[model samples]
Target: MSTSTAPARRSTALPASPIRLTVGGILRSEWIKLRSLRSTVWAYAVVFALQVAIGLLVVSVTVSNTGETFRGGPGANIPELATLGATAGVIFGQLVVSVLGVLVISGEYSTGQIRSSFAAVPKRLPVLWAKLAVFGVTTFVVSLVSILIAFFVTYPILSNANITADLWDPNVFLKLVGAAGYLALSGMLALGIGAILRSTAGGIAAALGLLLVVPIVFGLIPADWSATISDWLPGNAGTAIYQSSRIFEWWQGLLIMLGWIAVAIAAAATLMRRRDA
Candidate 1:
């Protein structure tokens, strides 16, 4: 039978489009990476505990020793005092945050996971931005919560000493927010350092040295320029965001800290783009 079979219909389906990378997707991926690490959990836990414990300790000591808290002389700025007590732990908590920040990126480099990350996102800068956003937001939220809890926990202690602050007061609330912002910003700065160094130990040491040792070294120098430079350092300037500073106002301090963070991140981004994974 030589019957001509009907020509098979030509397939008309279009090729499947490749999955596109997105900011949302990158952020989610970074979140997964951050939460998946055990160190993140432990580090955050320590931050929370330290904030609450130190707040309590400071307030308790203040009450027990003097039976009252005073800011200048007789009149105590209640809100300021409360803010101080709430943020007392940031000094210690910052060390942990700095280490965790360095670990976040350096761990990826150490374990060779950064290769996979870069492979997925060839541009690479998005990964750094995503990490910074996810980590920064998470840190700010956790820090704010911890600071609030510390405030509440120490409220009674402060109240007993006739030191009570209105949480609704803008001065008090803003200071708390500023404290959390400082932590987030500090961590982001450390993350940038980690990215640039690509070594956890070295990044942590450098970050900590810039934050702790450099300030001390500058302070010890017998020169006016050194004192001026020390005042403008990341650690010293950042503290002004939440605490009082004679040299810079709160907004000025925030701008200065942001400048430092921006410089760091810019360096990190440049290196990340130029260097191989």
Candidate 2:
């Protein structure tokens, strides 16, 4: 009778509830996560290096070949000239931004940390929004700094070539700021796409295809259709804002880019809200 009673069964410990999401907290967390990565640092380094190198190369070529003759139309305009010089490396720098953008979300999924992230911020949309916010703000600031550095570095070279230009011209200011904004928006667009796909390779492929390959392929098509098709391409729209002569007006190009960003974010938000951690 003394041995008939069974020992008391132990209770299993329950898992703790997930953290509540806050916009500011999530943004801060994302900021730290982004900065902690090697890719972000490398992207900035690459952008800085590429800008300097391209600026120097352009200066050397222009100086050696131009024979001290200033280029036409607002090559005499100081602000436009400054903007052109400042963004000379943008084509290359943008690739770095694309990589960083893709890595921001795709990297989390690749590492299987998406679960932890979702656990900490169960409201998935806010997490995605926080990422978009972080990338947008950082890309803008970084682009601005990179362009400024490029401008200063390129200035002496342009002057050395006797290619006189003004950095204070109003239109030039518009182009300069516009270039940074375009790239920043493009970066966030990529970030949204990455979040939706949640795969680095897939994100990169889709982004590069949308940004680079599609444009090239479309350009090869007969002009009869190219005029209509080009306007819709992301790269065509994004870069149009930066050109001395734009296919679409700056605001038009901006709206096109905004459309892309909005569509991307909307799709990603839907997927995030519906998907499992």
Candidate 3:
């Protein structure tokens, strides 16, 4: 009777919940992967250096070439001039950012890391989205910081030459932010290309061709339609974000650039889902 009354006690412990995959966790993991790469560090460093160096060179040249800064009526354009000097480096910086964007994803492909990445996140697309978000934000921050530093660093030189402009000027501030935004979008475009090609060299070439070479080729065509097409291209349209353009307004430029990025990423996501790691 005692033995029967002592019938085995049931365990009260509940089964542990399985760990769930989340966008936040994926983003954190992608960030860790990005920062862990030496190439990422160096590539970002080069971008920063180029932004500052090229800015300094441009402002210095402007001061030296012009002999003296404009005063009175001519000084009306000082803010534009200042913004131009601060952002001139983006032309070169975009190239570096593009290469870095390619390497970020394609490097993983080159090694066997992508297989592990896909295995962990069987749904795959989250990985691409996470990578794009992390890399885009990092690039924008770095580019903006470098541009601001360049602005301040060259401010003294510009002031000495009587080319002073207020940093807080609405027009000037927007241009600076726009320049950084352009770099971010450009890099994301390249990242999408990298994901599609899964080859670093080919992605870099394709990205740069879209940004640099294609515009030149279009310009050399000597037709009105060619010129119009060139104006609508990502590279040409993007510049209107930071620099005044006859072809498109800044907002229009932003939309055009976003359109290109969206197309690239859409194509990339489609291919990535169908293909093996």
Candidate 4:
């Protein structure tokens, strides 16, 4: 009996076949989880609708009172203005996306669903990478569609106001795409923060504080110091990607933004490895 029990224990201790954690499988799992959440669909829908409606309203008002519009700035840079029209709502929409991203990770923790995930994958980082990949791709595609629709809706209204713009203009297109990418990246960053913190409130606070509040608090400092540090803030750098005439060069701004994301993800990974969950 002792000998038979020993062999059974040894067999149980041996590892089973490993799953290689392929990207395709991970992506499929992420998509299913993402779509199943009712809040995600509603939040994104509201964001897109708000962006389009506000754009049309702005354009209509500008067309109706061309005199009032000129006070904001010159309208001749049609491309830049048009990009702003399409994405002005991103300033707030990103917060919605960020919260959604946070829940993508935190909700699992909240519900103890992550234990099942880990049991299935065993390799934790693969799950993280898969989630990031899925979130980035889905967010980018959705944002692209939202911006394009906003552009088309606004263009006609602006035209009615006697403003002409080319949607295909390089700068215009860059701004549109950049805005979409920015939203995607912001969501991923928030997800990483959530993974690190493992609490919805904590993650949201940290993400929002870094992206929004810190920039403002730092901005109050004297210009020279503020100018140097402010450029590196997550929101400032990420949003700079959309600026046709950026405060920092595009590459520099992008690097600063990516740096923030890298640090957050690294911290999250470290916690994941060290913690019980």
Question: Which candidate wins on lDDT?
Answer: 1
C-alpha RMSD in Å of predicted model 3 compared with the true structure: 5.7
| lDDT (tens digit, per residue) of candidate 4 on 121-178 | 7878888988889888888888889988999977766655555567777878888888
Kindly give the stretch of ten consecutive residues in candidate 4 with the minimal lDDT sum: 66-75
Q: Rank candidates by TM-score, best first.
A: 1, 3, 4, 2
TM-score between candidate 1 and the true structure: 0.93
Q: Over all chains combined, what TM-score does candidate 4 have?
A: 0.88
Candidate models: Cα lDDT each: 0.91, 0.79, 0.90, 0.81
lDDT string, candidate 1, 1-277, tens digits: 7887967645435465566799999999999999999999999999999999999999788768875335334666667887778999999888889899999999999999999999988999999999999999999999999999998998888776666779989989999999999999999999999999999999999999999999999999999999999999999999989988888999999999999989999999999999978
lDDT of 3 at 47: 88
Off by over 4 Å in 1: 1-18, 68-74
Worst 10 residues of 1 by lDDT: 67-76
lDDT for 200 (candidate 2): 100
Candidate number with the higher TM-score (1 or 2): 1
Candidate 3 at 95: error in angstroms? 0.2
| Candidate 1, position 25, lDDT | 92
Estimate the TM-score for candidate 2.
Answer: 0.86
Residue ranges of candidate 3 with Cα displaced over 4 Å = 1-14, 69-75
